[model samples]
Each structure stands twice: as C-alpha cells, then as structure tokens.
Target: METVRTRPGAGRQGGSGRRLTRRQAVGALVAEAGGSPLRRTMGVGQLTLLSVGATLGTGIFVVLGQAVPQAGPAIVVSFVLAGVTALFSALSYAELAGMIPGSGSSYSYAYATMGELIAWVCGWCLILEYGVSVAAVAVGWGQYVNELLRLTVGVTLPDALSAPPGAGGTLNVPAALIVVLAMAVLLRGAKESAVANTVMVTVKIAALVMFCAVAFTAFRAGNFQPLFPLGTAGMSAGAASLFFSYIGFDAASTAGEEARNPQRDLPRAIILSLVLVTALYVLVAVAALGAMPWRQFAGTEATLSEVLVRSVGGGNLWPVLLSVGAVVATTSVVLTVQYGQIRILFAMSRDGLVPPLFSKVHPTTGVPRANTVIVSAFIAVLAALVPLGSLADATSIGTLFAFMLVNLAVVLLRHRNPDAPRSFRVPFSPVTPVLGMGFCVYMLFSLGADTWIAFAAWMAAGLAVYGLYGIRHSKLDHGAGPQEGA
Candidate 1:
C-alpha cells in the first residue's frame, strides 16, 4: 500500500505519507489476500497457552537439568528470581501492547519512540530470539524424538549422529527433520497452527502434572540439604540460566497487531500469560528439586523424561508417555516461535524495515510462505550444525536484550503521547520501566563470553544488511510524523 525511501520518504522529506489509525494497525495488517493468519479469536486464554507453549519448552525440560546442577537445590529460588524479572518486563509490555496494538512486537515499539536505527536493532534481536530459538527448540526436540524411538521401537541411533557438532555428534538429522516438519505444519496457516499448538500445550501441561503427581512418592527432604552449598555464585548463575526459561513472556506482544481487540486483549494476554507461565515454572522447579538430589540433574540423554524414570520409579509406559509429551511440547514451541517470526517479518516488511519479500503472503495458506521457508531452512541448518549450549545462551541474550527495549519503549511512549488511548498502563510508571531495564541488563551481562561473541557477530551482520538495504527503503522516513501533524 506504500513505499519506504532511503533518505526520507513522503511524510518527512516532502512527500505525502500516510499514518494509520489505531484501528487500522490491527485490521489493516490482516488484510493481505483473504486476511492475515494472525487475525483470529485468540482471546486471553488461547494467548496464555501460546505463551506457555513457547515458554515451557527447553527451559524446563532440558535447560533446567543444567541449571539445577549449577545452583544446586536453590534452583527454586533461581526460578522465582527469574520470574520476578519477567514480571517487571511483562507489565511494561502490557502497557505498550495496549497503546501500539500491533504485530511488530519490539520492532514496532522501538519504531514508535526510539526512531529507525533502534527499531532495526530490535528487529535483529527478534531474529535471534525467534529464528535461532526455533532451531534450538528443534535440537531439543530431536533428542526427545530419539529417546522416544528407542523406548517404543526398541532401536537406538548412534550418539555420534544424534548430537550436534558441539556435543561430538556429526549431523543432527532428527533436529533438521523436526524443523522441516514444524515448517510444514505452519504452512497450513495460523488457525490450524493455533489448534495444534493448543493440543500440544495441553499434553505438555498434563505431562508435567503427571510427573509431579507420580514423582512425589520419591520425594525426600534430605535431598535438598545444603541448598546453597554452591553459595551465591552458583545460585546467581542458576538464576541467569533460569532467566532464559522465562523468555516467552513477551511473545504475546508480537501478536498485538492481530488481536481481536489489541488494546484490551493484548494487555490481558501479555500479563495473564506471564503469570501463568511463571507459576507453572515455580511449581515444576519445586517438584523436580524435591524429588531428586541436586547433583543428579545434569540431565541424562532424555532429560525431563529421565527424571521421571530415575526418580519416579518410571519403567513402564509412563516414561514413554512423558517422552512423547516432551517431544510434542518442544515441537509446539518451535511452531509458536516460527509463527512469531512470520508476523514480525510481516510488520517489518510492511514498514520497509527489511526486505519486502518477508511480508509476502501465500494466496493459498494466507501465510508468509516464502519468509517461513527461508527462516525454517536457516534454523534447520543451525540446529544441525551448532552446539545446544551455545544456541541456548544466544537465544537468552537475544530475548533479554529485547525485553530491555520493550521496557524502555513503554516509558518513552507514555511520556511522548500521554493523551494516547492506552488500554493498559504499567502500574509503577517510571519505576517499573527502570526496574525492568536494570533486570534485563543484569541478565544480559551474565551470559558467557562465547554467547557474547555470537551475539555481537549476529548483530553486526544485521547492521550490515540494514545499512545495505533497509535504511534506503524504510517507511518510517516518509510516514508517521508528529501525531497532531498528520
């Protein structure tokens, strides 16, 4: 409907640029051919499930195994600490989602207040958060699938081929396959994806509850002795790790432009999902720690399913069932991540923040087919080639950095447009935003050196692309002048 220019387009550099109304942001983005895949009922409850599907994956099943060993039994405290930080940022996001009410997520928020450059950086961060996370989740899924195969089919794959290069494995076929599979499912469009996502979410939660119920019998208070024997250093590290588990809190904002009533529903979805996810995380952490020794959680080949087996006297069909649930859980998260990527790219493309190709919609599926394939292929390669630990850390850094931007954007928007019809506002105003910023920065710094290097390189690559193309063809330069002026 519009074109973006390098220097300054219609609105700024003497051209007639159009500024969309609040209603238009949500409805217009969905008006491609037949409509956007994101425009669906997805009320608060479904949106909460979306967050759960995304948040409850590797963080609990695989990553927790590593975090538990790092922090000992105090991992419970780590989960809570990380949840607090997420809550702070979620509150800020709710406010912004109410005001902006669009799908760009951090990208749209940044563009609204921080100008063009920062928005591109946020969009780049989202690429890492969504794009890389899909691959990472797939890698975890491949592990679950291999475990399920051995349990059900009575056959085992060689570890040399099962793991990634980081883990001394050659090529992760299962990981790549699942990524492709998720892509196929997503190609069917959002409604179908949401239905599948909901079912997977139910299975994952039920599986978690089953673990808690059965594993309870093996609980021993002594298992938690010297809870902080590793001291503050270990617990802090665990907290940092636990922080990644809460990464999906902001996923709700990416749907802002598509919500049935974004101003109202977006805020509700963002906050409600955060609360549900955090509580679920705390309960899961409590159950796992109470049932086993702190040191045993280094995570076996099967991870969470292994906990059920080793700690819960699991040998019968229960372990198999739990493994199935984990496989479904990880798969659902990958789907959700991919869906978010499409919508974000749609926003950026429409705004000319990136290549317009990302915004192209498939006539059949009403989905971003080309962009989805491109992102999926890239993730498959990453999953097949990279190390899980490094991927996990990189995903965490990307997410934390985005949280920082969302929090700051909330405060700046409130100040810049106090009269805007914000359906929700953060409870503490300046304090909440500042607190959110501090928490994200702390967690961002806690990442390992390797993660820092990968993050820096990923960002540099994004900058190069933006400079080469996006800067010259951006919509912000032309449209969206002072609120009153347009």
Candidate 2:
C-alpha cells in the first residue's frame, strides 16, 4: 500500500527520469502477491547451494587449463586476486540486496538509486553476463561429456558435433542439449531446481576434494619454481580471465523474490557463497599446480581429470570419477545461471523495460515458463555456435561492467538515503565501494583489445534497443509509475 509516482514527461531519451524509490521497489513484492507471484520457498541453505552450484563449475574444470598457461604456477595467486576483487563487489551486492530485495539484482538497485535508463543499461549488461556465461559453461560441459563417454564406452562424439564452429565442430550438440535439459528442470519450479542443484553441488564438491587428495600425493615442491615466468602482467591477465570463474557468487541476490526471508538470507548467502568458493578455488589450484608442470597445461582440456590420472597413474579410476563430477558440476551451473537470467528479465518486464510475456508466471508452477523456454533456446543456439574462449571473455567484460555499476549504485544510494534501513551495510561506506569500482576498472583494462571492441558493439546494440522500444514502452512514461501486481 505504498504510493507510486509517475513523471509526466519522463519518456525523454538519455535522461535519468522515472526512478523508483527504494520503498516503491520493495513494495512491488507485496503488490505482486495478488498477481502471479513467485513462490517464496527457498531458504538460506538453498540460496547458498544455488550460488555455489552456479559458481563451482566451468572455471576450475575447464578454464584452469586456459588460465594456468598465462600465469604459470603463480596462477594460484591469480585465483586469489580475482577472489579479492569479487569480494568487494559481493559486499556491495549484499548491502543493496538486503535493502532492496528484488529479482533484478543490480538492475533493480540501479532503478532505485539511478533511473530507468541506467537500469535498462544494467539489465542489458546482465543479459550478456548470465546468458553468455551459461553458453560458455555449456561448451565446457561438452568436453567433459566427451571424456565421460570415452572412459565408459571407448567412444566420443565426432568433432563436428561435439565442438563449436571455430573449434573444429559444426555445432556443439552436447552443449546445446545440456541447456535444453536445464530448461526442462527450470520449467518444473524453483524449489525443484534448488533440490536438483543441491545434489549436484554436493557431487562436485566431493569430486574436487577427491582430486585434492590424489593430487597432493604427487605434490612437487620444485614445480613452484619460476612462478613469475610470465611476469606481473601475465599474472594480471590471468586474474582477468579467472574473474569469469567468480561471476556466479552473487547468484543468490537474483533469488530475492523467491527467498523465504530475503532481507536476512540474501546477504548471508552472498557473502558465504563467495568465501566458500574462493577457498575451494585456491585449494584446487594449488593441488593441480603441485601435481603437474604449468607449461603442460597449455593445450589441455579436462585438466583436473588429466591431473588426477597423471598423478595416480593411467590404470586408476580417479579420472573417470572426476569426469562424472564435472558433468554434474557443469549441469548445475547451466541450471542456476539460466534461472538467474530469467529472473532478471522477469524484473525488467515488470518495469516495462522488456516484453510483458517475460513476467508472466504460470499459476501452477509459479515460474515464468515462456521466459525460461525462450531464453534457454537462445542460449542453446549460442552454445552450439560459439567457441568457449570467446564466450568467456565476452561474459567477463559484461559482468565487470555490470559490477562496476552495482558498486556505484551502493555509494549513490547511501548518499541519497543515509538513514535507510539496511540489514547489511558495507564497512567504510564510499571507500569500499570506490575500491570496488577501481578493481573492476583494472580488470576491465586487463582484457584484450578485441574484447573491448566486442563489448563496445554490444553496448551500442543495447542502446539502440532502449531507444527504439524500452524508452517508449517504459511504465514510468505512461503515468502509471512501475507496474504493480496483475
């Protein structure tokens, strides 16, 4: 029952008009209860598992090979660096999530503190972040699926079917299929997806732990020599690449509308999931480095599996076991990240920034069925066509841009609403958020020139969409304020 305000001439392009007050943003949740509301069934445990599941795959299993060659054995340090950078943004996300508690994550935060236009930009960046990252992870999953098939049946899919176009395959069939499978799971409901993710997260965690035990048996102190062979620049580049690994730590924030007690659980889940994932990432990196030479990782895929086999000898069963874990791991990542992406679109649709079909929740399942199907279909096609390295870099740049805005949003909100109730407040206020912005900029710079060009193109396309459609159709422009309930 909060009053809503609309700006009469707010439809003007480029202006920061029609901003949602913090109270208005939170109040929309209550209003939606009478409409097609998302079920509030997730607890803190499920939220943590959702973040962990979304995070624990791709990077360690697949990108570790790509990153190790850049930083040598010092790739261990690169993981730590990326984690610290993610820590700063995670703090910002925690504060805003507790205060706003919306499905849009950073998009909602921008709408509250900035304006609808900025929020549209942020939402567009999230589309790149989640959508492309899911495709990247699915591409990696195809590799593990190949390995698993090799060990079990002494067969693998043909290269044309198993890999993306530039990577020797005409289309990555397994990658596309995995996304389709995750789409089916999501169509069930959020609670069911959480249950499935919990099981997968457990399997992946256990698999990594098993890898550590076997790898440590062959740990060599000499492997640590020449740690800085690629120099500090190499280490920074590696950190930028590995930053993609930490992208899903704030995933719990995307579940604000579905969490049973979002104000209390969202902050705890965001911080806890990041801390846990960082610790595990560092440990796994150390184990792999000690067991193998950094130079050998250059062209390797299925790195952890290879490390386990090489460490324990060819006849051992560890590689097969690790492959199983990897399959489960990547599957969960695709599921949870797609879930987050759909929720972000749902929020945007509710604000009249996207098509209304995205926000329509199915009564029986309490999920956005059409949105899930359409997004998953596009992601599947992207996974089928794009190379993993390109997708990963694109996702990293987009995620970094979105995170920079989230950090800025925190400072702006604090300045504008000094006495606003916050279950969690980032320590040191503007200093922490400013450092967060600085770190994001540094990582963004570390990315290659081609990545920048691609990002620029993506941003240009987003602006075009906003100008053509989003600006004209925005709820605020119609003197209805933000859409409320059905």
Candidate 3:
C-alpha cells in the first residue's frame, strides 16, 4: 500500500474565492481498506452480456420507430453515425476503466482528474443518465408487455393502464411492474442477476436474428429508394436520437469493483459489447427498412413485432413469438440498467455525495438493498407517468454530458499521470479523447431545446444538493485517511 497526499490547504478557496481545489487521489479511489464490499463475481463474458442486455432492447424494439420518422430509410446511416461517436468515447472509457478501476465509473474518474465540484456534477449527470434511462427502458418494456398480451390472450390492458398520460393512458402499470420485478432480482445477489441477464441476452439476440431471417425474406429494394427523404438535418437528428441506443456499452465500467479482473476484463467488455451492439443495431435497422416502408414506422410502438406481423401476414406464429422475445428483451434491459443505477448510487453514497443508505450493502447478498428499492421505486414512478420520448431525450443529453466528462478526464489523467499502469490505452491519446468530446458536443447541440432546458434544471438541482450536503460530508473534505491497495 502507498499513500499520496494532496497539496497543503487543497480544499480551501484561493484569493479570488472562486477556484476551489479538492481532488481525490486515483489510488485512494481504486483502493479499498481490505477489498471491495461488492462481490467480485463477474467475468469478461458476463460483463459483456450485462452491457448487451442493458443496450439491445430499448433502441431496436422502441426508439427505432421514433428515429425512423426523423431519418426516413437512412436510419441505418444514423445507427452507424451514433456507433462511431460511441466508439470514440468507448476508447476513452476503456482507458480510464483499466487505469482506475472503481464502481464510480466516470464520476470517480472526474474526481481523480478534475476536482470534487466537477466530480459531483459528473455524478449528478450519471444519476440522470442511469436513473432516467432505467425509467425510459422500463417504459419501452411496457409496450412489449402489451404486445405479448395482445398476441397470447387476445386482449390487452386499456390505455389508462398500459400507457403514460397524454400518450393515451393515465398510468403505465406494466412499466412500473417490470421495475419492481427487476428490483426483486437485484436483491437476490449480483451473480444471480448476471446469470439472469445472460439468459435474457441470449434470447434477445436469437430473437433479432430470427427477425432478420424472416424480415429479409420480405425485403424489397424499392423501399429504400429515397434514402434521405428527410435530408441531412433529419439524419443528424436521427443520429442524436439513436445515440441513446449506445448508452449501455460503458455500463461494464460501472462494475469496476465487482469485476473479477477489472484492469483487463472491464476494457475488453466495454469495447466488445459496443462492437456487438453496433453490429446488431445496424443489421436490425437494415432488415427493418428493407421489409417495411420508412414512413410506416413513424408512430409505431412495437415496431419489430409489427414488422414481423405485416411481413408474414397477421395470422402467423412469428409475430406472437417475436412479441414474447421482445418482452424478454425489454425485461433484461430494465434489469441490467437498473442494476447499473444502483451501483453508481452505491459508489456516490460511499463517498458521502448522496445519502448513506445507498452505500449500505446487505451482509448476506452483498447488495445495497435500500438503494435498490429506492431507485427502483423512483424509476417505476417515472416510467408510469412520463412519456418514453421525453425520458429518452433527457437520458441521452445527460449521458452525453457525462461521457464528454469521461473523455476530458482521460486527457487530464494522462497529462497528470503519464506513467500510470493501464491494461488498455486509447491509441491516439489526446486526439481520440478530443474527438470524443467534439462528437458529444455535436450530438448535444442536435438535441431539442426542451431537453437542454431540462438538463440545466437537473444540473441546478444537483448543485443545490451538493452545496447543502455533499460539500460538508465528502470523505475527502473530512480527511478520511488514505485507502489501501491501489
């Protein structure tokens, strides 16, 4: 174990009373006194599947329809564009995850490289990104639940119970219910949750493969004629929207403390998961566009299932089976994404950035029981009341902001500590991270004004909370002795 000390009077403001300096040492952030409280049971394979499970469902099953209306048949181009953007950030994430393996993900990275204030802001953005993303994914899950009901029972829940208000229904019961179910699974233990996610990921991948097989059978070249029906601006907007599809790729980094081999496995899982997800997204988009006209996707809720239904005719088993697969797919997404949210809060809480309750891991399960329940409950309420599109856009903006910080953190960390050992490194260093930041800014600008306003409001609230609680209770502020074992 090694000890690193900050400069004298580090937390004190300078003469100008504006610049406040308090950065957590990277060594202290990664090191725990004995070992991490969270169980280290996940391997590279399960870690990759965790990311896959969190990402594969929502975008393809739900947001694809929303994006198609923006880009027409060129939505495939949008998927590729979004993937490229994610690749840049993914490289940065890989580098950081390997260098500083911790459960805080970007938040802890920012704390080590940037200062505590900026770190708090980054953590706040993650709260928005992961928490609301769980809600957004859960909302999508409700749509598939309704589809499954219609296919099997031949009767679906009424709009009031199946949809969010103004979208036709007063409350989304299925959406909230799915969150509760995921919460229960999480309470059981990390290994159990990972195993469940792996099974669901397998089923979802097989379902998409089945969809492509059947969808390609009905492929019509004519449907793609006016590929840029909505033009370049539309394509950009579509790409911004589709960026949400790639949100879960970096999720593996959040399991830093819980990974069997964080230095090696975290980087491998992040990059591998992103590649697999991007390929699946592009293939599914092509199959969907070739089989159905772009205009028809505008307002479709269960786009994939409907595509199968129309392609194979209404009276077939394919649509029914696809709906079942979707239900499983979305369920897996809710489970994994919710798990990410819980872990992030656990990290923040341990640092005294949030309430202590979140950091309390259950003795037997090695899970944060209270944190899981609270986060899941809040997400369920949001999923029940909020529309999917609004939740998705908000989540994208928050995630992009947090990712931009991660990219910047990579540059800062490399400049500050060039000799730090890393299992993975971004090939181009500063250039790659700079490009990642640029892409993030470009997508951030593409989002609507409303989303920006919401983001600003959320950031303001976070600052207030930090000022009132986090600033005083931070372990660094209190001089909680150095952590052991970097």
Candidate 4:
C-alpha cells in the first residue's frame, strides 16, 4: 500500500495520510473545467447565492402543515432545536471545508481522516440527506404545483400521476419533470445555472417575508391555547420533521474548490446561510402557526398559504404567489442538489474510488455529465414512482448520520493534524461535536421503525456498491495516490 492508509481514523494511527493535496484538489477542479470550462464561474456572492438557493426551498411551506399539530406553538422551539443541531454540524463542516477545501465535502474528509470505507458510508448517507432529500422536496413541489393549478386555473392534476408509488398514486410526474429540468440546467455549466438560481432565491425570500408580514397583521393570541396539546410527544415529532427543511445548508461545502477563498468564504457561507434560513423559518412559523389553531392544520399540505388567504382576504393572489414561490424554490434546490451530487462523484472518480466516467467533465459545460445523469435519474425515479412518508423520515435519519460523522471528524482531524491549516475552528472543540453527535443520534432514533428500516436498506445497498466497486478501484489501494504531507 502507501506510506499511510486512506481510511477513516487512518490519519490518527500513523505517518502522513495519503490524502489529496490542496494542489491536487485545485488541479482536478481545473481538469474538470473542460480542462478549463468556466474560468471563474463563482465567487463569494455566487457562493452565498448557491447556499441560499440550495437551502430556502420546499421545507418551509409543506413542513409547516405537518409540524403545526405536532408541537403546537412550541414548534418554534423544535425549529430552534433543529437549527442548533445543524449549527453544530455546520461548525464541524466549516473546519473540514477549510482544511480539505475540496469537492465531496464530508466524503473527502472521511477519506483523508478515516478511509475509503467510511467515505463510502458517508457518501451513502448523503443519499438520505442530499439525494433522497431532493426527491422529498420534489414531492412537496408536486403538492404545491397541483395547489396552484386548482386555485388559479381550476385545473386539478389527477392523483394517479401526482404522487409517488407508495402514496396510492401511479406516478409523481411533476417531481420527475423538475428533476429533468434541473439536470438540463446542470449540463449547461455552473455560471448560467447560478444566475437562474439567484432569481429563484430572490422569489423564495420575498414569498417567505411576505407570508410572515401578511400573517402577522391578522395574528390572534387565542390560537396559542393548549400549546403542546399532544404532550412532549408531539413536540418531538415536529422537531424530527423540521429536520427536512435544513437539508440544503450543507450544499455550501460542496463548493470547496470553487470558492473565491474557501478558507474564508466556506465558513462564512455555512454559518451565515444557516442563520439566514433559520431566521426566515422562525418568522414564517410564528406568523403562520399563530394565525390559526393547530388542530385545524393537521392532515392538509396547503394549510399555511390557504390560511393566509382565508384570514387576510388576499383571495387567489397571495396563495398563488406562495405556490409559485415553492415551485421556484424546489426547482432551484434540485439544481444545486444535483450539482453537489455530481461534484462528489467527480471527487471520488478522480480518486479512482468510482468509475472514471464520473470524473469526465462535459467538453462544453465542464460539468461531470455522466454522474449528473445518474443522480438525476435516481431522483426522477423516486419522484415518479414513490410517494412514501417513510422515505422522507429515512432521509432525515441519513442526514443526521452524515452530520454526526462530520462533527466527529472535526475532533479527529484536530488531534491527527494539529498543524493542518484551518480557516475556522468549532468553539469548545470536543464538547460541541459531542453535543452535535448526541443531538443527531437522538433524532436518528426518533424516526419511526419503518424509516429506520429504510435507512438500513440504503446503507446495505451502499455497502454492496463500495465492496464491489470502490475499494478495488481506489487509487490508494495500489500505492498510487496524492502527496503524503502536502
């Protein structure tokens, strides 16, 4: 093998780990740019926009309907809990993004600190958080699109082609369409895609603020009575569901190489983006949940915006705008989600842990064409074929696992490579990561049995893929690898 093994915790046990040097990371970025596609397609501004684009999507709109009855008015604390948990992981991610500063985010970190096996597992968990996360968003998007159609044009989509296979429907057609559209945009290159996403982000922000301002005007205190009506059980359930809304914040890390100065920008983007999204979510939840009784909100996906029009007298104008906002947000999320997936594959491909085809950037677009297609198809199938709640819960479980790994990694990296350059460090070191880990673990078990079962199945499938393909193909296996100390 090489001077140092390329496994999780491998860095701790020995000599220099065979991690990719910063130069190698930068070189691969250049090679994948059609050998130079978009010379400078991103900056601090674009990076921040991408962060916002990735994060401010479907969760806020649909999740409120699901969460309101569960936590009552205390759903606010649940959101805060979820956001705090995310901040812990974000702090961990900040350190890794600065130190590794490469594509694949946590996967790359696991590779450098742990090894290929851990990296594969981390990548697999991403399916729940990143890949399936998008599919979940697409399902939410389906709900909104149909809502808009019925409200404005009086054209209701049939349930058969509108939901996943598990939801007693034939297909989720809108979800698949959005995935396809995202793939097309990704194939065009990052700069143009970022531009489109910027517009979508703006729309999403406007819709969120408008929703809060409008609902706040018609607020009533009586709706707060019997808060936590279902007891702590309900509040816990709401917190678990709200986890879905924060999925996109990690997308900031995937731009490790593309950032103007990753050391500085990545940390800023991660923390800043989380703060921004959390603040918006709190405002919207307070306004929407406060305006109506929680018992009336259950079992309906269009509860928030519908309540807005009913309470505020906006009629069709406001609800339509909210629907449009959700659609735009979901579309942009698909784009950024696919982008992160491709770049992670690209990183793995370059390291020879995956088929070389995934590393090949399109001649024209400079994007990883094959990987993008595969991820896009994966999302489309789930969107078109399945309408399962268990899948969404499983997604949260997966994301929490991935975040736990990243959090633990922060501690591991510090002790292993104390000399390594870090643009940001998590405060209180082990305590923060430990708390982060505990928080995620709690959420992981909080998922229902069916969701846990689904998560296990995904993990099993990923193991098979890695065992059959990754270890054998890994560049580190044959002693062909990056610099030892960099």
State which candidate has the highest TM-score. Answer: 3
Point to the candidate with the largest lDDT: 2
Task: Give lDDT per model, in order.
Answer: 0.75, 0.84, 0.83, 0.75
Task: Report the CA-based lDDT of candidate 4 relative to the real structure.
Answer: 0.75
lDDT of candidate 2 over 341-425, digit per residue (tens): 9999998898777899999999999999999999999999989997756546777788888899999989987876677789999
All-Cα superposition RMSD per candidate: 4.7, 3.6, 3.3, 4.6
lDDT of 4 by residue, 1-486 (tens): 123324533333333233222112322222342232323457766777788888888778778777887788888878987788788888888888777777778877776666567777887787567777788778777777898899888998888889766677888899898889888888887777778888888888998888888898889877777666778877777877787678778887887766657777888888888888889888888888777767767777645688797678867888788889888888888888778877777777777777998877777766778888998998889778966567666877777788888888888777766765677889999999989898888877776889878888888988788778776666655445442333
Error of 3 at 155 (Å): 1.5
Q: Quick one: how many clashes does candidate 1 have? A: 5
Off by over 4 Å in 2: 1-4, 7-36, 69-73, 164-168, 225-237, 293-302, 314-316, 386-392, 482-486
lDDT of 1 by residue, 1-486 (tens): 222222334434433223221112222332331244445556676676777788878557766677888888888888888788788998888887777766788777777666567778888899888988888788778877887888899887787777877788899898898888889988887667778888999998888888778767778888778889789888888887777777776776776645566667778877787777777777777777777787777655336667767787647577798787888888888888888887888888877767888888777767788888988888889889888566566877888888899899888767766776778888878999999999999878766899998889898999899778776666545444222222
Q: Rank the candidates by TM-score, best first.
A: 3, 2, 4, 1
Q: For each candidate, what TM-score against the reference?
A: 0.87, 0.90, 0.91, 0.88
Task: At residue 470, give the lDDT of candidate 3.
Answer: 86
- What pairs collide in candidate 2? none
lDDT accuracy of residue 55 in candidate 1: 81
Alpha-carbon shift of residue 126 in model 3 (angstroms): 0.9
lDDT of 3 by residue, 1-486 (tens): 244453433333332122234667777776751277899999999999988887787567767778889999889999999899899999999999998888888988888777778888888888888888878777777777777788788888899898889698899998899999999999999999999999999998999999899899999999999989889888888888888778888788888888998998999999999999999999999999999988888767647878878776657488777777888988998888888888888888988789899999899999989999999999999899987565466878888888999999989888777887889999988999999999999878877888888888888999999988987777765556342112
lDDT of 2: 0.84
Candidate 1 local Cα displacement, residue 50, angstroms: 1.1
